[model samples]
Target: MSGRAAGGGERLSYFEGYRAIGAVVVVIFHAYQHNRDPVTWHWPLEGTTWHDLLRATDLVVDLFFVQSAFLLGRPYLRACLDGERRQHARAFLVRRAARVLPLYYTAILLVWAISNPILPGDWPDLLLHVTFTQTFSQAKIFYTNGPAWSLAVEMQFYLLLAVLGALAQRICGRLRHRSARLAVLLLGIAVLAGACDGYRLLAVSAWRLPDTYWPAWFGLPAKLDVFAAGLLLALLAAGGVRLPGAAARRLVGAAGIAVLVGGSVVRLRPGFPETFVHGVYGAGCALVHGASVLGGSHGPRWARVRWLVALGGMSYSLYLWHEPVLRLLDSHGLLPERGTAAGFGFTAVLLLAVSLPVAWLSYHAVERTGQFVARAFDGEGRRREYYRPLPDLPAPPQIRDVTEVLSLRGRLPAGTWPTRD
Candidate 1:
């Protein structure tokens, strides 16, 4: 697609709002992202209470995962369906690498700079971050920064996108029917994902071993479904396919609320039979998409909570800096215990206390600077150098998506494609 052709369109405003929510939810989840229980003969469901603050919040990560898949997959999936599938495959990989790696490695290096040099396998862990394949490894993602683990997972999804995306184009080219192509992609995804999940749980009992003990890189098989789910959602959106409009949105929104509330219900009653996970959780994905899509495309109407949006703007930075700050407090005993209301309050307030300013400057200094530098390098040849665009981003100031900017990078200006100035 030409620059002009790609630049004009209505993007999803509800999703931008939803992105803010997803990022914040994930950040909250990451603030206290995990639950601990000793090995037992009984199912690990005990003590995993819905009212339990830390455990309850872990659900937020699910929101983050779904959002990541939707946003990243949109345009590429569009290009594939447009018979220009090959166009995005290269730039998508490059742009994705650039967007993620700089901030990612900087965080990793910052951790390395402060920690013991001689710690066991520290060098290898650092190597993992640099290669952007750290998710496949078993290392605790950041020694000081716990949230980076999810970032690693997100990157892994991108890598999966790069590979599967190329194959998808090849397969899509042979099939003339859009419906057939979509069907094949969906079915491949379903079979592969279900197998992977099964393998991850039943076969890979090696969770107890160090990450290196497992031969695979990044639980690729296990997590493939999550990424596939996102990819399909993107395909749906990019094709101009609309799910249930107002009515569907309301229905799905109600369902999502029910599932979320069901967690609370499961918590309040004994022997309530935790039905959320094993029964129809994937349906919730479609429901959330319906709610967001059906809400329609419109800007924020309320003047109130604008700062929340601004803070949401810096959510990525907060993700980067919040955990370390929390760790700093927790190490010093500034934090309250985990189960108490006081513990949740302490974690939340302490995160916002330092994160607001830090996240703001990070957007300007780190994210924006990194973006500018990445863009400047995107133009090909000797005129521009170093980390040129990966071929997905829309050109700077052209009102294109992020991928188009990368695609414009290192190219001979933007007016024409398959042409050199």
Candidate 2:
């Protein structure tokens, strides 16, 4: 909570721990998908609780979206509410590009080079992915790497946030009071979220588009509600809302966990409507994240464990590479047999063992480098360049000599040398 986490000097909080847990769970979910038999492993209604939880892990992707929105939105919202200088859109986009594009492009190339023979796609698919427009194409959405679709969504969110933030800053400038500005911004976000939710319902229920439809279901429009949850959380935090005490914070956290579990369970029920499933899950994630921020302390002790924090720092790379690593292991016959409890445990453990080191390397090589580049290019970096201290000049020797000579001749008073122009 106090000290910075690994990647940069960004503040560390319970969110990093959440990132670590989410990344690991996603890896396990994919592992289960690969190893389970579709014939025997039915939906949760007929399956075990473990199976339901495994299935529910897919929802963890929304947690990443919420986290991103909260982290990025908080500063902008604070600036608006407090009447501070607004963030530059160009600088924000540049930083986002530096943080996201490098690793994403790397993953695309790596996956293409290694998996082309097995998971083939054409040049247009590659082009779409390169432009972060793959999510618009049903065929290309999961082409290079399945998890990369989320990265595409994240890129879209970044662009949208930059634009919206700039517009919000301008609008807030016209408002008379902080509360008025905050209310107007919050209402705008709420309206946007409501519109997205309506679109999702129409797509799923009325139009009868499958939830797997790329543009309607997996795209930014469908997912903005989740991001709005984070944006709202940021607004509340910016407005100075806080939990009164540890007990209240704990209670909120417990309620969040309950909502999350309850949502997951309901999601697994036979014939549950898909229209609101993701929204419910997003609400739960928001609640949990809200409690973490509103709490007075750093968080629970477990959330601050050094290794967990480190894992969280490397989580982006881990999320990107874990699936490919798992597939590689499977191809080489390194993984255990499928459909057994022992096998699942072994596969999960082996994936973690192999993937952690790879993720650590990627984090250092790609992510950290990206952060450095972002800092070197953004507004702060430009300002630093402009204000950099001038190197100490060799003490204007000619002037000093002239003063000494003038003083010796008594043409200038002692300690009253002429000032340098």
Candidate 3:
């Protein structure tokens, strides 16, 4: 989602799979947007179930938000609830910037060079984007690259989450019981999420702003509820809550998929309330992620498929470049003819073919390099190291399980608890 591995040398294959699927869905949605004949189907074409469903793919963006929040929030939640050593805010933010900014800035410059004309007022727009404040401005929200608005929202969330984590670290210290601390933190997150949802509703109802208004509906406040859903998942995981059995975990996951599909379908109906749409969608995301977390060492077999995991690794680049690539294809007459099912399918496939290799390159050259650089700045002196396999060497240290570490806390010395930070 943010091109960063999970904290503590762990990976959640299911979440990676989700990113891959969500990224592809978004690319397809964009292809549909640019390739569809305005005269025939038009934007927001109603009474056509399949077309409407394609349009609904826009909501998959929310899943990205949830994934980012859950992955990033989990470690902080563990520190608060389990007394693990917390990552310093400086280190946390620096790593976040490295994960996000490199590809983002490159995308902006490429988009501008390819599409936007240099003008007197363009500098300010570019400046806004460079600062990640583009979402706060109506004109600049989708200025160069449209999908980058979500990146802006993500950047804002990073700052907010860092502050909240610091605050939680302080507040959690005074609480005597872990349960009470967990309860307090959960309540705080819920209340904040509620306030955000209420602001979103007010924008639509009282301010008479359309849900499609970028500045009104796409900013950090409007999407914090979705992130809060992820934060709730992190809290549950940190608190060691699990479903009763594997059967229950599987059932819950199935139900989560049902809810996600059902919510998208319900969202297609005319005049559905904006108030409930996000809440339902976020809930579904949380359920699915929670089930995956509880499902044991390796999640569902499909999640670990080689190609899917690789695609997931490069999803951020795919998301960044797909729209511009789609436009380039259209301008060069490379896209298939518009307005037919066959044409749509061809366009989607063509976009993937052109975009996938570019994404792979970006991941290796930009994302991985940025992460390697970030590791060099680690405050805890954890450097990226390479090792060779040898029969004579002792077995590599196994990645410690968070639950196991927590369980052994009482027996271990206070300063000796196993920690990645």
Candidate 4:
């Protein structure tokens, strides 16, 4: 329950605060999208800049991915840079599975049960969800848990990190300069991401295929740049790389804020490729994240708020459950009518009130339990290695010169000669 878990690195409270904000923004974006029926009605602020900002808040999910990559990648990057080859790739997979699968599977099953009819053909989609390959499958990507496509992307990221970690270990062995090693690692990640982006753009432009069909936007390849940004920041922060003066750092932070705000409010239509837009948005988030790490905070008040910390702690669970819960609300007629200011406002309040408690429960029941199970496995492994049985001891050599000892003592007992008795 503390900032850090057992045997884990220190918690970045600022990132935690950012997660809370990002999660809330996602919830609001979904609320507006689901409730606003453009064909039927219109709210007072529906066409205003405020409404555009609300719609564009979906970009906040990039922030989520950035934070996830930075936080989760930090330890992996540390081990790789330290030239640790015995990182136990299987153990890494098991640990990640334990942390991610429980709630993810639960959400998938719940969505399947609630949304889809019990049909024979639907089983394949369940298999895809279980294996986290739905993002690659045409029929299953948006099947049950609508928002879980990101989880699929993230799963690929995890596997890729393991591969990259090994590569970094090998490369670090050959490189003498720490800076050069870091540069090589960054360049490798950038090239890979850029290659993916280029492929996606080429496919979109040349093939004349719909962008929505297994689109690169939702794929791990397209998202790699965002993750790479986070990884780069973590690497630099960990390596204690040089930075500009304090004033310059503050200016960097300010610029990050500007880009984020500007990107959200201004809409980009279909003409501009999404790859470029997302790259820019992700860059802004990475900049903000790096600046926060360098500057030592994400604004004092937001980072320090008790409720925000709690919300951030439960952000993952909230994200998993809120969309489905909103659908349930809409089906039951609990939510207000669509396309009204009051409707949007009320839906936001109601969803937040309901989703927070559900998220809290899921965190306690699911996420915390998964973490505990993982710790138990780690502890068991350590105990086996650390608490091995001791070796047997040998008896002391017999005293062959007892008679000399008795002569020197000069005060032997009467029972010394047991044979005489």
Task: Summarize candidate 4's per-residue lDDT along 1-421 as a digit string, tens digits.
Answer: 1112223223366566777787888887778777766686554357687786776676677777777677666766665566543465556666777778889999998888766665664788888888888888877787787778888888888888878776777777788876777777778767866876776777668865566776446777777777777787777766666446667667877787788776654445646555555666777887876665765543445675777877777788888899989988988999987877777888988999999899999999999987776665552233125466866544332344666555535454433432211
Error of 2 at 47 (Å): 1.1
Q: Provide backbone clash counts, one per model.
A: 23, 0, 0, 0
Q: List model 2 lDDT by residue over 262-283, tens digit each.
A: 8887876777765467777777
Best by lDDT: 3
Greater-lDDT candidate between 2 and 4: 2
Better of 1 and 4 by TM-score: 4
Against the true structure, candidate 4 has what lDDT?
Answer: 0.71
After superposition, candidate 3 runs with Cα above 4 Å error:
3-5, 8-11, 39-46, 116-121, 380-421
State the TM-score for model 1.
0.70
Query: Stretches of candidate 4 above 4 Å error?
Result: 1-11, 38-45, 82-86, 116-121, 242-245, 265-270, 296-299, 379-421
Ranking under lDDT, best-scoring first?
3, 2, 4, 1
Q: What is the TM-score of each candidate against the true structure?
A: 0.70, 0.87, 0.86, 0.84
Best by TM-score: 2
Error of 4 at 187 (Å): 1.7
Report the lDDT tens digits of candidate 3 across residue range 1-421. Answer: 5834455233486667778989999988887777667687554333577776886676678888888888888888988997898857788888888889889989898777666555544777788889999998988898888899999999999999889998998899889999899988899788879988788778867887876677877788888899999899888888888788888888988888888888888876788765467667887888887776765546667877878877888999999989888888888999777766777778889999999989999889888888777877757435544563634533333336777666665665434435543
Candidates, ranked, TM-score: 2, 3, 4, 1
Error of 4 at 217 (Å): 2.0
